[model samples]
Target chain A: MVSRAGVDEIRAILDGVRDPEMPALSITDLGIVREIRQEDDTVVVALTPTYSGCPATRVIQDDVVRALHENGIESVRVEVRLAPAWSTDWLTPRGRERLREFGIAPPSGIVDGPVVVSVACPRCGSFATRERSHFGSTPCKALYRCDVCLEPFEYVKPH
Target chain B: MRDSARIEYVLRFGDGALVLAQRLCAWVAHAPVMEEDVAVANVSLDLFGQARMWLSYAGELEGAGRDEDRLAFHRDAREFHNVLLVERPNGDFADTTVRGYFYDLWASLALSELAGSHDERIAAIAQKSRKENAYHLRRSQDWIVRLGDGTQESHARVTRAVDELWRYTGELFIGDDVDAVAVGDGFGFAPEALREPWLERVRATFAQATLDVPPDTWMQRGGKQGVHTEDLGYLLAEMQVLPRSMPEAVW
Candidate 1:
């Protein structure tokens, strides 16, 4: 089993990559990094899509390979899994904060958890946004039009 | 509206999804372009996932205790309800595009109406599905126009696919067997009305693509009553074998 420090190191190494749309947020923060396994002479990273069928998968994969190589780690294999599904619930607080700073609202509240407040807009800090469509931008986020800012944004659907 | 009829209806929808999904998977390596392949494959996966949900639900209705695998695999060619369009071989990317565009047009309307069905279960499923179908419809329509208008080769090929597949278009609007149970119990939206809007959408897209809207003449109709084209039988054979052979394997 990989130690906690090893995971921390991996996380640090992964920081080199950011959500291409929301540049401030790292891939790990976006909740795409599902697991990391260390074998005899290799490191294998497993990931779940942000939503079921996000278009950014190829870009993210390339980023993963580039980042791992930059860290002087060879023999790295990235595996993409669909089971158990990925949800916006996986977004970290820092990630959410970063998404807002990037002009895209980070998903708010918990999915499959206790009833929570509705998502707030990162632009004007309003919860008055209305959902326009479920499949938006890339297919992972639902499009919402913020009445306050009169702008459209993507909301990560809770898995 | 016996249990079997319901199961068949569900299977037809599911089978259509699964079959198209298999064809879409073929593009994983040979997509005309890079991004187009991923988008097509992803949409195909969405359809397959929907198929699993519908078939599993059908099994429950059948009370045969069969799951998705049994419904997907154990069934004979005669049992499938999918239209001929999905089973038609993918001759080229244009053929696939035309097929997808045709299906998306129908599915978008079908799911929208189903979202309001009297059956709470189907309605719930439709609600989730309409979202994806809407995306499929939008993306496919966009591509149809792009290909239909793009170049000499694409224009010629896309038009041919549309002409070849146009005969199958009328079958989607028939709403025959579906009328038996789809709206009998409750919130089933009238299937007949959807045809006109679908036609309008088709016309708009075809016009945008500058392609002729072939007359809706001599339409091929049958799948709703379990009658399918020859190609469907072979598709069923390939799709059903693994589940039938294994008997109880879970993956």
Candidate 2:
């Protein structure tokens, strides 16, 4: 059985792994890493993708595996689980902050709710922003424009 | 027999998604606007992802040596089980939008019900897929309303597209032996149960768009039973040509 300390070390290693698409945030910050547990001698990392169709999922999984191996962990397994579906609410406070700093509006409101809370512009911090398109640079984002600054930005749509 | 029924049920979902994704991909560079191009492509990618999940799960249930690629590429036209609406040719921008609108509504409702499935795997996939389908429905519905209510020409075009496609929509909710087995097992819902809600929403959307709902006249059927329109053969020929020719090639 692997020690609890070993699991913590593995997690710390994961913390250094950044999302390929959103490099400003770690996978943990994005809430993709569902669990980290030891099965016998192997460290198994369970991950849930942000969206079922998000293309970054496969890349993120590979990064997780590579991150563990580079950290002196030879026996590592990565499992992708779809249960309980991922929610934007899982975005860490730090993750939301990083997204703001990166000029992308973080998701707001409940996953399945119809009420869309107006997203503030990350550029000029203006409340007067409008959606340009439901799709943005990636599958997880929507294109929005700041009326004040005239800057077009991406808003990570709440899943 | 039970496993086969499960596989069939899953394949129905997967095939519908795959064919629709292929149709949507055809619109990538051909959309009327850049924003719409991106939107359609994103929706297509989402359906492709769903197709991968469902087909992969179906392969696992089948327990034969088959996987997603094998089922997707190796199967002939007669073996595919997608609804006829998806495989129809993309007649125009309005036609594509209407097709997507109809399918998205059905898919959204079906996935919502499937989220409550007794099988954990199916429930999980359904839960994940339902979120994406919501976004898809929103996109399609928005375009449909825009075209249906925009102007004389635009409204007329969308109306014609709606009428042309109405017959194909009936096949979506007709249950068969495979559906019966799945419903009995608590892993699936009878497609019949979804029609009322589906039509209600369709009617509301049409009302908002200022478009009349096409009469539910004699509905065309048979895509569910591996019987498809000639269009599916052409679609498969285009989609499967590369894989068929270069069987050993890797992407």
TM of each candidate vs. truth: 0.66, 0.98
True contacts kept of 2: 0.73
The deviation in Å at residue B147 for candidate 1 is 1.1
- Give me the iRMSD of candidate 2, please: 0.9
lDDT of 1: 0.75
lDDT of 2 by residue, B1-251 (tens): 88888888888889999999999999999999999899998989988889988999999998898899999999999999899999999999999999999999999999988999998888988888888998899999998899988999989999999999999999888999999998899999999999999999999999999999987699989998899999999999999999899988896
DockQ of 2: 0.80
lDDT (CA) per prediction: 0.75, 0.90
Which regions of candidate 2 are displaced past 4 Å?
A: A112-114
Residue A30, candidate 1: how far off, in angstroms?
9.6
Task: Kindly list the per-residue Cα lDDT of model 2 for residues A4-105, writing each as its tens digit.
Answer: 898788888999989889999999899988888888888999999887777888888888889888878898889998887888989999999999999999
Model 2: pairs clashing at backbone N, Cα or C within 3 Å: none
C-alpha positional error of residue B216 in candidate 2 after TM-score superposition, expressed in Å: 2.3
